[model samples]
Target: MSNVTTKKEVNVFIDYLARCEGETALRLNVDADGEVRHYEVKLFEPPRFFEGFLVGRKWYDAYEVCSRICGICSVPHVISGVEATEKAFDIKPGKQTVMLRKLANLSELNMNCIVRIYILGGPDFLGVNSVMDIAANPATLDVVKMALKLKRLGNDLTDFCTGRETHPVGIDVGRMLKLPDKHKIEPLLERLKEAKEDAWKVAEFVASLKVPAYKRRVPLLAIHREDGYALNYGKIKSTSGFEVTPYKHDEYISHKHVKQSNALFYSIGEGQSFMVGPIARVVLSFDQLSPDAQKMARKYWGGPEWFHENMPFSVYAAHAVEYMHTTDEMISILEKLKAGMDESEIMKEKAIPQKGQGFICTEAPRGLLYYTFKFDENGDVQFADIVTPTAHHVHNLEQDLKHLGPSLVGMSEKDATMQVELVARCYDLCCSCSVHCVTIKK
Candidate 1:
């Protein structure tokens, strides 16, 4: 951290926020009167054009290529794309396929949240530039060690089911090419069951951090499943009390590229922005959390009102709670698999793809990621649209930055800039997954 001299104004341009994924900039300008004169968020990382790349490909190919969009988000991207494609062809996977897919998602969510809450957000709360700054610090190093064990547990779970951690190969349209039998699932279930104690320690460690607080009240949106806390399946629900099916996202949601920027933002109406991810999940579905997670959340925060849109720091707490939820739920899912409670869907032959459109929303580690596809008669993709969680969040993040300006403007350039950067970290922005090529610049 640098010290502020006599400068009344300072510009902060982070080439890619340290610790977060991808390369992008969060630039802010502050004036002498404790006011933010200029606030701009430009996601200029060169684009991959995944949607365009998928067009003219087969439905299965869409899932394959889309999974390459982000390493952290691969599970959700691949799962959502597969489910949407299956829907387009009116194919339904059986009990085993659904359970296996949920396990993969839960594994990804726990690992991804660990990275965000402990690795990226850790330094910010510790008043350091990066985790390396605190690697030798006795107080914080234990959290890092705990995070590593939890992270491996998540990756191994995914690997057992998906064949590899990143860009899993097994999952496909309708069902996976191979299913893990009780023999393979039992050991992993034991590992997950054993990790419960560690999960509690990490949850308590995270809740002890003093996250900076604010009072902005943006709407939080997440998937709402009737069976439980929604993850892979549910209608989308907003904190403002609106619900819509996955297929109707197009009807109720609209997104456009911001002026001079390629990153597309989603909105429900004019001048409206909403949040997603763990914070939204907890706010919108706290009661739905597993009993263990609900118990942990109750230890620190008083009630739902304590989870505010402006308090981006609470996102860390939200992740911790979700980590417990995913861990507990995975143990249960694995037990079900071990008991032969349902028939393995792989026992049936695969279905053929047909002409039609399909849509789906899966709760990724970040938030609800929506995918839509139109297939030709031969099951080749004719059109594709992917609405990433980050796409829906860029604007919401900027809004929080702008609102926090007053509190930071009076500080020296160096101090204020670091604090503002923490504000962005609160969102755990994944620039690599969100940035799209643009004709405009800031």
Candidate 2:
């Protein structure tokens, strides 16, 4: 047995994750022989306490308040809260409302994924320090231009429908509070159609980058919609062969408090850490993707093989595939809405809250997000539990680090540290959302 060495110990404190969303740090404990015996994925941001504060707020406010949890994921947060509240009140959104919300979410998904794949994760794969580095180089300058072009289209679509790109103000308890004018839908649709070439360019650029070779077999999970690619509604399905409606989440998912970090770690079954995000969704729902996207995925990563191999870095490629799907789906939805624009039907009536609990799952850009709420007859929230995608997979990230640490033993300190950061970036951890819940043990 090797003794724990106090001599020549290297304590690496990574204070800034250049591409990650919020305040986070990694503490690595490496022994004299360069073996990482212990590590802590530390989150420095103060807990947001969204659940605690939301308990007594009005049901209608859940959608608005929860959106503040994350700027990058506001659409999914708002949609999840609105859907869960509607379920609790026995309210069904009208067709127009559903279409509008779906449009906003898909647009936001594209916008968010573009940032992750091109700006945040791209620099790592290209052997550059940052996106600015890529932009500065004459050889890669065109790639940046294409990324911004596609990203702008996504932002314009999201803002056009929801009234704001970040914290959307258009969605309400049962329907959209505002709809895009009939005259403007055609122009927006035309713009979306025109951007198809740009979307393809960005996807091809990402496909060409080479990710580090590492594989760890972990269970994959995502929202499964049989009809098409799931954005807001679906059953929670896992590669482990179990599918359950979102209402059954409490029965299967569990969260625990770890002393190393402020974020709560989530697991399934008997303490098994599973993955939820772009890679999981792309692998599990390949057939459901748009036609061109599916064909491209087959060209690069084989059909069934992507699911069988649980490579964390493949998330970059998975995100590229999604970019294609979102553009096509957005165009289809806009065309449908243009054909039928009925104002009266959309604004019929909103339902009052009932005394019961509701639960829901929605696919955010990062992964599966779950929300459950208990409301009183007066439409006031009595209990609230919100789980972000980061909380769901932070434990899985740590597990990957544990397995990867041994192999990095003989590498240079700078090289080992960069390797660790690359793996963390693959998960695209949103530290802001994960720190929403924390327990202080006195």
Candidate 3:
């Protein structure tokens, strides 16, 4: 078969595999000129009907219900959901509450990033079929074991803060059910210290790989923070210097509906594309990284290219650096929480439901996750809006493929196919999060 026809065949195979992840479809047509004739990412996960479903529910109900959006991204959904509700009610959670929330976000990041690197994305980069294949191989078995340990730390952190890791309970508006006990926090911090070392090993392994020398000029976007890395905190920062409060998401950022997909894709008012998630966070929030992580980034990437351009290779390094930073940051946080451990349950507040709107954006494992809610005087949800990182990411990934097409055209079929898959997997694309924005057809 000619190389052009083979590359097109691989694109078809990717679309088939995408169904296993979510109801997503991709169509790429390359013209005789070896340029992209057409490209589209269509997501058709069943309509969730979430916004209409929450219409008459109390604000506190959002944390649990919105969490159902995606099993992997539930923690951020819950945290950002509560933040939006708290903003509408004008309530600020106590110190301990905020600390616990931060810990939960870190845990989610660890779990998701590890699975993507060692399992899903691993095979693509290694030219193997799956993590199972890697695990069964004598040469690579030890690598999989190390990855499991890192993923376990994320689950441990989640379990410590919220009695349940997935679809966590006890995080109502203005309330945190109970902080992890001293007993739990003490042991977890110790294990995390060890996990830090293992993370370094994982980082070294990923850094040793040959990263694709791909670059595209899409605008990068992420939440901005001054105190530290943005997680359930900060204002929106885009590569273009466009900054806006979360409330203005609807005003400054806009979404477009394509008949081919169920998800709503976003842009910065002018219909321009932008990338989000780890690459955006790592580049935009570089200064805020801990000293250790900054040193590591310098060691691996060795220059400022990642911060200035959209190089997919930077995504792996960015994820590795953040993985290390989160381990240390969580250790520090656990020590403090352990010292002040108390047996008290979440305090109840008789907050009167105020009539207003609330908006918030937080860094989730995947990238910039956002939420907005409007409430009636009775505190019932009048309307709700959510934009997951995957939705915002679709355009950047497709654009990248367009730029990457020419180089892929004449390569050996297998090499060409793998390169295309590697590029798609680089975003760590989470179709579940993207197609989750679906609604019932009117």
Candidate 4:
């Protein structure tokens, strides 16, 4: 056979292999004028079993139970869940307690940012399969070294602030189990400054990548306040301008059941859709970023327009800005810390037997996380609903993939797969966080 005929047969064979291996494909049908007429992202469910284990647990224990939602994000889950409980009880943790909680959350954000950007996004941008590739690339080795330095800074700060890195044990019902001395906090603040600077440099490097020209106008959802992008608390708002408080989260949000997946499908308002997470935060609070972050953002991207339209390349730059912002916030709080508050000051009153509903909304590193719980007289969980940001953004990921596929229809299969993987990473879709995974078997 001629070369064209042989290549055509090979292509057909590879397509058959893809189908047999159960590889999920994004099929895009493009019209004569190069417009996308139809698109879909084929998603296959990966093995996950955590949501089922959460049913029937006491409200007080939900914090510990839901913490397992993701090993990387356990601290945020635990702290946010506990805060929701406190809100339901109408208890305000003392000033010192609140500050400590903020510190812990900031530490978690810093660590997560490092891992996602340097360890994950870095390799992908450089066309490498993993961090090891970056280490091996002579041109990218400095980037790898800087990422490691920043990661270490996050790990050390987390250990000092929360008493451990992977799973912190400092958070409690009303306060931290223990507090780091001023001496320890002082050095950590210095380390955070260094990490923030290094992260900014890496972000600049990411901005230089040649990203595909993909755009989508999906509505971005996040908590916004007059103050700025609320990290630990605020009202929920969307890119299309819908806004509500945490107490009314259910009114604007709803979940659907998808076959073959335990993950709940999320929708905003009346439409089956996606909401929350990093992209949403960047869209909602682009103006709130610090001057340094804003300058860097513009250097990488012209303005909010680049981020608002679902550009996957924006993830690295946005993550860097958030890391710097969170680091600065942590340092300010540590500087303001005062002595002389007894443990009793930070602890809440004895647990009372009463019916109560509590709601808490915080900016998890991934996106907007919400925890709501109704407790009975015995402090048992009568009703529990935890809406993770990852779950909220799944539909958006699907939508993006669907739109991207048709553009790659004529490309080589391997090139198409790379494009899809890049889109998936844009959402920073942590199947570990969403209790769902997407696998390309072929």
Candidate 5:
């Protein structure tokens, strides 16, 4: 064994609140070898901390407060939180409400995929510095155009359902503020059909890459529903064959501390590490995908080797499959609405608030997001806990880095750093989701 004590510190900076204002700071840190020897990940008090300040407030207040968790995913957070609160009070929205929520969630997923591919994954795939480079490339301009179309389609769908794309104003306690008539939603369905075709092309292209050879057998956790692959609600199932409802969520998951950062490290059942998100969900719910999606998965990822590897390309493939599935489902739902699903006629019931706990598990763009809220008799939030998928995978990212680092001992620092960053990006770690701040020190 080498006694060099090769220490590495990795720091990921997050400045959501600062950027929301005018001033921004990049938290930094140093990674010794591949280990986070010293680190800080900056978090602000405005949004997440503001949530903690919402104790003793009415249940509806959490919708606006937690919505600020990340500007990108605010809609899902708000809707999911609201839904959970409603469930706690034993209140259920009518048919139109359910349909609208589904539309919004699917729209958000579509937009998120576009952003991930164009802004993040594009540069990494093309070995370029940014999407602008890809856009300028004549050969890849079609891909760029497709990405833009998909993003616009998502925005249109959001507008059709919620009346605005970002920070929508339609959501409320009993029902949404807006209703979708045929004229409003038809154009969106048409656009989604086109977008779904384009997404398949993207998946085919990604599947053509020579995937890297790395496979670690870790427990996969996801939400499984009896009807189909659930995006909005389901029971949490593990690769080890253990399944539990969201109400028993705390029994299966827990978080801890690491030396280098304040962000909580996660483990399951006496150091049994696991992973969640796109890959896990796809693997566990493969049979639940739409027919088109199933065909595409087999077409692209049919080989036995594909099933054995933990390649990042699998994530892209799964994302594309998920996009297709959600789009198809949205179109079907829209067709139902056109066939006489009315928004105004459904009955609404008033719910009495008692001391209760609400639990929810939904698939965010990143993966499974679990939210738990404890409400007092007045329907005021007494306590809250959110378990994000990214948190569950951070330790695995570090482990991959550590394994890859020893092989790069003789290589130049630049080359080694690139390798590590690639691995980190593969996990799609949103340092913003973490509670700690990041800082790099020499």
Candidate 6:
């Protein structure tokens, strides 16, 4: 054998991943000896400019506009945007307001995770092409029904709290424009209580599936709190043993430009990239998970080492655990709301824009969602920046492919391609939110 050089470009189809979130292409270069040399995770979507156009808009318009970033994650974008605005103006929401915001965040996390774990990731575990195919098979039809029912309940909970299901309109900075109806709380809570069994069924279903094994130890970053599982509130903590407030994220996590991607790549200083999302959150905050969720995690995920090891495929398993945890949290919050609604929670105050800067990093269902904003004295937005979770994961996914691609040297192209897709789906990439800016050189 003299020499062999092969190049292949693969476009990830919608059927391979969950609900056609967006498009990403993979380019792999394999050398003559069957060793992989280079890989590029190409993002084709045009630059969205969510951050670019935000300048010159009013401060209050930030969340409403940024919320359009992802239909699946509009709630998280809104919450992050609102929190960033609150920080800029020095507005401190009451405890009830914080609790209700947590409810909103948890509701979306529950909904997004159910979709990813059951409706989306389920087909992969079951070795099927699409969820429709899962429904067509008599053996898995019940699984489909259960997934849909659970998804519906999640949507209802999100809608009840946020106003509309997607791109919700009831929440704003410092106050709730619309509070959840008192009469509806009892019924919603009852439905949530009833869904606990269904939640377990989904988790058990995931636990039964075989997870592809490929391990790597990349820095895992998440928002952490000492008192409880942190979603909206907490300092940024990483598996590397570094803690930084959200304001200093720029000093630690830095963004880079790559010709292969329209989105930017982020690293925690030097050339090392880090992973964020469900896996990071679960690993960093395992101690803070609800007791029931912890029991399920240990039972299904094979104790803590499986997570501590930082296995990429374990992301699916992590999503299942988070689903269980968020359900328990939602029930607890709903019970409190059912007992009585505080007048302060529903009250709204007008925000006076001051010339100041604010920064926030919150957990979206997929992972860390970050936002920073500056306002003029007249309450107009002087500048805005957002770093979505999908953008954060893309580079790490490429790094994972580098580690996994060499293993595919002897396999058939089709089999090798699928293994690649499996890893990508594991990140639950939301491409829509990732492609925010593209570089243009004059």
Window of ten residues with lowest summed lDDT in model 4 = 8-17
Scored by lDDT, model 5 comes in at 0.66
TM-score of each: 0.93, 0.93, 0.91, 0.84, 0.84, 0.93
lDDT of 2 at 265: 78
Better model by lDDT: candidate 3 vs candidate 6: 6
Output the number of the lDDT-best candidate: 2
Q: Following a full C-alpha superposition, what root-mean-square deviation does model 5 have from the true structure?
A: 5.0
For 66-140, candidate 6 gives per-residue lDDT tens digits of 888888888889999999999999998877778888888888888877788766676776788788998999988
lDDT of each: 0.78, 0.81, 0.75, 0.67, 0.66, 0.79
How far does residue 23 in candidate 5 sit from its true spot (Å)? 14
* Candidate 2 per-residue lDDT over residues 126-199, each given as its tens digit: 89988888989999888788788778888988888888888998888787877787787888888787777766
Candidate 3 wrongly placed segments (more than 4 Å):
1-13, 18-21, 258-263, 307-310, 342-345, 350-352, 412-415, 435-442
Per-residue error for 316 in candidate 2, Å, reads 0.6
lDDT of 5 by residue, 32-72 (tens): 45443322332233234543676788887776676666566
lDDT of 1 by residue, 153-230 (tens): 999989888989999988988777777656778778777777787877877777777667655788888898767988
Off by over 4 Å in 2: 1-11, 32-36, 259-263, 307-310, 436-442
Model 4, range 67-171, lDDT digits (tens) per residue?
A: 767677777888888887887777767778777767777777777777877676666666777888778989878877887887777777667767787767777
Which of candidates 2 and 3 reaches a greater lDDT? Answer: 2
Q: For model 5, what is the error of residue 426's alpha carbon versus the real structure, in angstroms, after optimal superposition?
A: 1.8
Looking at model 3, how many pairs of residues clash?
0
